[model samples]
Target: MSAAFFSATYGEARQRFLEAATRAGAAVGHHVHPLTGAAGEEIGTDTALLGPADAGKLFIVSSGTHGPEGFSGSACQLALLNDELARRAADRGIALLLIHAVNPFGFSHLKRTNEDNIDLNRNFNDFATPYPDNPVYEQIHDLLVPAAWPPSADNEERLNAAMARLAGQRNPGVSSGQDKHPDGLFYCGTAPAWSNRTIRSILRAHGTTRRHIAWIDVHTGLGPYGHGEKIFGRHSEETTRRAKAWWGSDLIVSTATESVSPRTVGHITGCAPEECPDAAITPTTLEYGTVPNPVVRRALRGEAWLAGHPDAPATLVREIRQAVRDAFYVDADDWKGMILGQFRSQALQTINGLAAEE
Candidate 1:
């Protein structure tokens, strides 16, 4: 399946994924013209179905919430649909839902955030939480997005220092600590963005009736190179134990271990489970590794540059866009192989896990 879609762009990968899902006899639903992109592209996110609509157990795999990271997830979903797994899903009475490019605007424009620069992951918390203020983010906001095209050396130093301070905090709660960077990385939005709202709505519509649900929101740009960390949706002992017993060796609970992800605020799956309390929702993020964290931060700097300077040179814009893509996904055969293998393994494990529950 990786051979079929080699080094494809986000749009290309998404289209191929949808085609494969349809070929596998999956019903498709499109959120047509739901949002517009920065370049005014009519971006529509689509959800493909592979098994029965009302199966007892539902396996939901979504990609591209962060936009550029969708390439790898999209490819993995397409590969799984093309493989024998889709047939197995149908046979086992497990409903397989493949959501491609949840953030179509970011995917098309090669940006991680949406048109309004809202990080969808951070926009999922309840409004009652008051959008947890980030004073640190506010302080470094200007440094991250400079008035000039490319940031100066001093600006880089200041940004690096702030990131170092934030990253060094060992406490889980500290990661989501308030910062004053309105235009910096990990900027939680002023309010719930369109993507967050749409996902919550989808969960309410599709996820409410399921007896058991296993959601794997695909992501990238963290952890060891090429490794996919299975981050649990919430920090619960029972859920962690269940994930370990069900998914076995592939599972990496971020709440339990400090290896992959630190506990943070505003997760998409976390909100989904909260919204659909009736269902036994087991949300796990399949985060594939790309560059190192520092390198990823640098790539994000480039993204900020592009976002802050709309009138930048064409060459710089192209370079920044490509850099952001490369940061999350390496266009190599081995990396693609890892992506497909990890996703397939986790998907099967999740299906088996749900079956065990039943």
Candidate 2:
């Protein structure tokens, strides 16, 4: 059942994934994280590979890029393994790689960002060049991360006004990617984050020789409930056309008016083009909507406050933690079903697309 593929905690989800991969006869590799999980459980990025090491085509489904959002992505990956989708893809001469828990710290701690509070999606930019500046984010940093969990009404009003100004902007300062404020929302790190380097390393290891690579990075906290928004963010006209052809007209170009996400810099999917320069890269983020924008914003603000103030009351800490988790993961049977159905369709689409003639 779909519900069985999902789990309440990251540890349980990891265990289920490892077991499922084993049962599927996959070659597994674990990239252990230096930090421990919220419950003190071991956390790491796990990969299950199916198909020849020299396979020219690669299909990747990655879960847990946004911490608790991993619950849905993990479920999807588990469903794929359990349903023999991996085996099927391998049989078709396409390598199927299930990358579990790309951001294990956030996955285990229920935080959207990683251990360093860096948003992994926004942490993939080149450090040698000048970083992207967000003057608007700088102005609203104080308003976004207040000293208290329940921020003052004055702060809320000011923050809301700031958000209102950014309503239709291509890159909303808050979520776009920032480096000035370490404790602020969506802090793109000053340098390559551990997960950023890890992802690059993984890509170089498995994808350097591949002629074609398709990546489906799963995320949450945007759009309508249970809807998986297919987001493509690359700039190349050629790859963009290929992505459109594969994912269809419903695919949302991040820079387009139809996209629910921001036109942010430093996307994780960008790593593929850099790591595997010769491969034809087709990438999309499957962003599942769990809650409304305001609720998600509130949860992120509260969680950021909690991160800065470690001495807060236990009850308040629990409340903020649960809020952050809930904002990303909807722990209901119906939601799981929606996730499974949509994810399965996309997975099959990717397999068939890669299997098609050039």
Candidate 3:
């Protein structure tokens, strides 16, 4: 059953991934995270590679760039490992790289950002240059992350009113990314996060020699429930045309007017060109929807509040964290089935596209 491949905790998920990698005869490796898990268990970003190391084509699937969102991504990776996809890729001489828990701290602790509260998705820019500005994010920062866990009714009313007036003006900072506020939502750090560095290193090692590479960075909590919205990972015309040809017309270019995701800078996939300059890359984010947009926003705000107020009551703490989890993961049998089914289909399409030239 699809539910069988899913796990209840990050520790359990990591263990299952390692065991499955061994069972599949994958070349396994680990980059240990500095912090322990929520249960005080060890934490790390694990990798498993199937097929020849020097394969000309590479297929990379990564999970947990947003912490709890890893639940669906991890399940998809686990399902792939146990399936016949590996053999098919190996037959085509395509190396399948499974990167588990790119943000181990967030994955283990149930927070979307890393230990430093940096949104790893927004933390992959070149640090030598000046960081991007988000003045609109500055305007709504106080409303988005109020002083209290559950903000007063008055605060909510004013925030809602402001949002209504500013509708279409810009995203409320959560999606656009920011650097001014360290504890704010979607905070892109002033420097490269460890997760950022580690993932880039992984790509440099496995992708440098590849002629063609396709990366699927699995995500959750956008679009309709249980539907995997394929967002083209890059903005360039060449990559955009190739992606549409491979993933079909259903693919959503994030820069489009009707896209679910906003056009944000410094995505995890943004590092690909710099690291794997020689390879032709087709990247996408397979985002599965869990809850509605408002619900997801509330959950994120509550979690951000909890981060600043660790002394919160245990009951309140549990409530906030549970909301965060539900926003990213729908732990039902049907949802698991949908996630696996969509991911599997995309994987097959990617494999076909990569093997077409061969």
Give all candidate RMSDs, comma-separated.
2.5, 1.3, 1.5
TM-score of each: 0.90, 0.97, 0.96
lDDT of each: 0.75, 0.88, 0.88
Off by over 4 Å in 2: none
Error (Å) of candidate 2 at residue 109 is 0.8
TM-score of model number 2: 0.97
**157-191: candidate 3 lDDT, tens digit per residue:** 88788767655653433467888888788888988
* Model 3 / residue 115 / CA error / Å: 0.3
Model 2 residue-pair collision total: 0
- Give me the overall lDDT of model 1: 0.75
Which TM-score value belongs to model 1?
0.90
Stretches of candidate 1 off by over 4 Å are 1-3, 34-41, 135-142, 170-181
Residue lDDT tens for model 1, 230-251? 7765557877787788777666
Mind giving the per-residue lDDT tens digits that candidate 2 earns over 89-125? 8888899888999999999988998888888888888
